[model samples]
Target: MSTVVDYTTFAVGCLLALAGLISLLAGWAPTWLRHVERPRLFGAWALCLGTFCVTQLPALRTEVIKLGDPAIDACVVLLLISAAALLLGLRRPRRQ
Candidate 1:
């Protein structure tokens, strides 16, 4: 299989990777997120889905081309959910 991910997939992959890194860092080091009880779990999900997107981008494209929607849908929906988790977690106040 070709190593090249097409432009759209590459763009999504890059975004996912950035989101994952930010989520993981925020969950681990940022003082504000420390108060969020489960930031790390969101981080894990984001990182995992992001890594999956990046690594499997080629196959993902293939799945799309083949009209196998579930694989592609899962990647996008799961990542969005995880990203939302990180965002919501960031909005919480630290424990007193």
Candidate 2:
């Protein structure tokens, strides 16, 4: 059924969002807090979050008819802004 499909898609989106958040946090945390040294971690997080946003597209298009497109657009915009900020912060030169 459509309801079941919607729920499944939403669940997948939630998992992707959670994974992205965890990656972002791990990458942003101070060196003392994070154990891994993956240099592209933040970029990976951004990619994951972007994929999450893409997965939600169908539900935003068909299921949420009353709310219109603004909500989804807002979410995408916010994700983009957050990703940009993260990248900028990471790129800032370290002050000695």
Candidate 3:
């Protein structure tokens, strides 16, 4: 049952990864995504999220998430990366 759930999560993560790839390549987003000022960074964040999901699987989690250092788990790293990307993406460049 847990394996089945992991596979399902993996599928969703893959889809998110694909979307991130497209967004990164396009370097632009539809008007509906107006908030994504830096599409590439946003895409990077999405990719990180996808990876995080994949790392949650029990088999992978043992290798990816070191319980010894809870602060250094795969999910935590991904979250930090995504947060940085989001912050940088949202902030506008200052006018020279």
How are the candidates ranked when ordered by TM-score, highest leading? 3, 1, 2
lDDT of 2 by residue, 45-93 (tens): 4545655455565746565445668855756665776566456545445
Q: Answer with 1 or 2, whichever has the higher TM-score.
A: 1
The sequence of per-residue lDDT tens digits that candidate 3 reaches over residues 25-47 is 88865467767788899888878
In model 1, how large is the Cα lDDT of residue 45? 56
Instruction: Arrange candidates by lDDT, descending.
Output: 3, 1, 2
After superposition, the stretches of candidate 1 with alpha carbons farther than 4 Å from their true spots are: 1-37, 64-67, 91-96
Tell me the tens digit of each residue's lDDT in model 1 across 42-93: 5665565665566466655576657767766766776677667666655466
Each candidate's lDDT (Cα)?
Answer: 0.62, 0.56, 0.76
Which residue pairs collide in model 1, if any? none
**Ten residues in a row with the worst lDDT in model 2?**
28-37
**Candidate that would win on TM-score:** 3
Candidate 2, which segments miss by more than 4 Å at Cα? 28-72, 76-96
- lDDT of predicted model 1: 0.62
Give the winner by lDDT.
3
